[model samples]
Target: MALKSPRFASNAALQNAARSAPPIRRGANGQHVAAIQQAFIDLGLGMAISTKKAGKADGIFGGETESRVWQFQARMGLTRDGIVGRDTMAKLDELLPTAGPPPKPLPPAKMTHKINVHMRSIDNPTVPEFTQLKVMEEIYAQYLIRVDVLTGQSVGLTPGEQFTLNIVDGDCKWDQVSDEQRLLQNSGSNQGVGVNDIVVYFATVLREKNGETLQGCAGHAPTRPAVMIAASATDKTTMAHEVCHVLLSSSFTPVHVGEDANLMCSAPMCTGQPAYLSVAQLNRVFASKLLHKL
Candidate 1:
């Protein structure tokens, strides 16, 4: 017979591991396995129903794992398809944090709209160093709202979701807390997140000469709550680019040249970096269709 998990160790110990940056794919014993028996255990989730079909203790995913994932998706208020994609991953990361339950909900899911979200916008905030970053956030936010409205799931923030910019200049300790953070901060000059409705954007020590090196970086959505991170608003173009990443993060991947519109335009159009004004201009209907399914 397969062995059951031992009892919970010190919450302090778990917190310590979390603080020291525990491994993402580990068991209660915190050792390597062919596959994770249940993800919840690693994330400090105990005795949750399995979403996969295999035996409850089976390492690989089965029906039970699927079920639990859907429940998680719903509780976290995401599009629950049972499959753990970027959106799901973002939600999980936001919720199953080793530090304990993730941060409190930023806002509640408002009216479920049947309308396709046309792009929305807010006045661009003024910032000298990260001007591009700010524009990117605004534009990016509009992009997500538009996509959610169109896809029939406006997974953006509710009203009152505030955004704060926390800059830890020369504070090496900020990156020293945990492995996950250190890993991100090591390469996170262009990352940001929507905390509840409050999107907290991050800029790292690497943002020099206005984040030109990170223009290629795109936003990512993991399984958890609706959160995202983008490049700082220091560079002139960083804001717009990062905003595009943040808004398009959940339903879309900002990278993937194949996803770009095939519109034949008189206005300048760089392969991946097109001014995303109207979806009507998008010649790639196939990509747009695929985005909704995601």
Candidate 2:
């Protein structure tokens, strides 16, 4: 016959029992299991138990609770048995907070859109130092943007797949190139870009008419959109700048307001190195369909 759990008079009694409690094997049920489960949750090892199924620390030492205890044992470098014996209970007692319960986490805001990026490299087919994680970090640091990579691969660019640069002298030809031309020219082996997603290609070289090198450039295609960043533009802020252009462009017109120390303003025009978007620019980004707001 299965053994029934021993009941306690109160929580103080349960906690006191937990300090010197005996082995809590499967099939046992009582306030002891509830106390142990709550202790597990408070210690930041919550994945062990299915809270939804267990429901407010049900006083049952069943398979689920046993499994949770086993996980806790494994994490604590103890025996992996599915039993909470004297040693396990002692460890739990040692780790349990002496103060109040753990603070509840705030619910994350709903993500409006997920920007799927296709990272392509030139000749050697090498992914840049600026990875998807770094990209997410940069964009999310400033704007409330939700971006992710399509697949976890540094796709190789064939001989033909190169960023098309406009030949201009004494100035950056970033705006001279159209989004349509940029997409069509670099549309090599890019069969995974979704309708709402964008492609970011890292090219070998991007020079002007007089061989003047540019840091990076980007354009937006309302019909077919993509952003081509120079591999030389290694900084995260540069990537953020180009991406901002793609998502927050106003009717293909220059939204970059010069004379301000912001991300939109570049060198010579602005008094700083890396800049940021203005309040108006932020409003534009927040209003865009690409971003999900709180």
Candidate 3:
């Protein structure tokens, strides 16, 4: 029997079928099967289904289609049952681009926070301070909050404070004060930082007593909020992460989360572009004294 080419009224129709259709397996034949096959092809999995010829997606679920389903399931870490069930369908929907209007822009900011930046004279960060501030603005904007730069300056460091700020024991305990951190925060280096403004210092290195290098830290003397960022660790998201630490404060237990998508995830592991803050984290951020009405 000659096979009929898969057909759909439109891409939206195909997407609808792929999303709402019931489970499909081998022996199935029609537009629903075709939708799934087409979705695979759309996701660059056409080679598995194109047995007869390239780009050929017949409205038939045979051995080739079943094999394709298995391959997709494995790739998505779903059960390799060769059936397009709810889980498999959901994964496909997530990967496929939506066919619809663009998302609406967020409304104006309702609240604002300020940051005071101080960079060591010898430090050269990979991500510039201005660019880092912009990234922070974008991340906080989701909560209708605006981040403003209160001040930015380059401070000359003494022989001891230059290049690397030695952290005692490499411990970032908020309650325990490290001499380096205390000196840096109280040594007038954070000049121009108001009580309500968060202070950020960019240093070339943040080395621990044990020879380990840290990307950044939020540890400071009691009642003094500050963030220290290492030049080597200044990715687009590091500043936000450290500032979030100060906002969250030592009272927030379980400071680090396991999910890489979260902003609180420890550095070198968090990979989310502009990592997101959870609802719980947002609540804490709003409660911080640094946040003020616009």
Candidate 4:
């Protein structure tokens, strides 16, 4: 069956309903809840919400609906409370109109790269693994490059490994291999990480020698190319930023760019901007040893 466009009296009405006592939460059933569910589906989140027998939004708020709400909240940087409150309602109102029909599937890409992610069990990353992968996929799709997750897993860490997880004084020295970095990168179980694949470690905390915390860093052993991401900094763009570092490598002079919208911009400045790459940067990325022609 075709998806029916969601109808609401008005954004004001939706907000009013969301502000009502008791709130619109799980187990509630009505057109309002269905509208929210349909909004998620329209936003290309159908895989997470469509579990009903008919595989459609059924005006029922169940486990699937609640999970979808949590995912949506995570994406919007809202509290993942699984409730449609004032804030969630506002975000829904702000984004729903832009949530047109999902894009048609694309043909096979001419170039591709594999990402091997090892997430620490203790890290408890803010953004979910699948969400992070989706973000990377969307950013790279613009360049006609396909980003594939070669392996993803949660692994426990030893006390010693946990203690030394932070990049110390000499760890960020990109010119030579650092022991601290090598130990951390090789601490977790290997997931068939290939020479050409980019390895990403979602650690509990990625700190600099100066005691400043970092969102993500592309520091790795000479042979093992990887990026370390702080659990708290797993926003939509951090992974992409670090991955760009790996692709650019040390040969690219001035690794960090000054443009806020560019992917290579320094942290915090690049926080909320739309990630973009220039023609010259794309040329550098395509020339990397890791990116392969499909």
Which of the predicted structures, 1 or 4, would earn the higher TM-score when compared with the native?
Answer: 4
TM-score of 3: 0.59
Model 2: per-residue Cα lDDT at residue 283: 50
Q: Which stretches of candidate 3 lie over 4 Å from their true place?
A: 1-122, 160-170, 267-269
- On TM-score, the stronger of 1 and 2 is 2
Q: TM-score-based ranking, best first?
A: 3, 4, 2, 1
Model 2 agreement with the true structure over 1-294: per-residue lDDT tens digits: 111122222344344444544567777777767777776666654433335555667767654556456556645666756676656765654554343553442223334345566665442213353553474454444233466767434544343433332221233333345443454335463677666665665555555556766555564346445555555554445555666776675454455655344556555233222233444455566555655343
> What is candidate 3's CA lDDT for residue 6?
28
Error of 4 at 112 (Å): 6.2
Model 2 misplacement above 4 A: 1-113, 123-127, 131-136, 152-185, 220-222, 250-254, 257-261, 268-276, 292-294
* Model 4 TM-score, 2 decimals: 0.57
Alpha-carbon runs more than 4 Å astray in model 1: 1-195, 207-235, 250-274, 278-294
The best candidate by lDDT is 4
Query: Which of the predicted structures, 2 or 3, would earn the higher TM-score when compared with the native?
Result: 3
Displacement of residue 79 (Cα, Å) in model 1 is: 23
Q: Count the backbone clashes (under 3 Å) in each candidate.
A: 57, 4, 0, 0
Q: How many Å off is the CA of 242 in candidate 3?
A: 0.5
Residues 61-142, candidate 4: write the lDDT tens digits: 7655665676566566677667777677766665553446534422333434443444433466787656777777766764
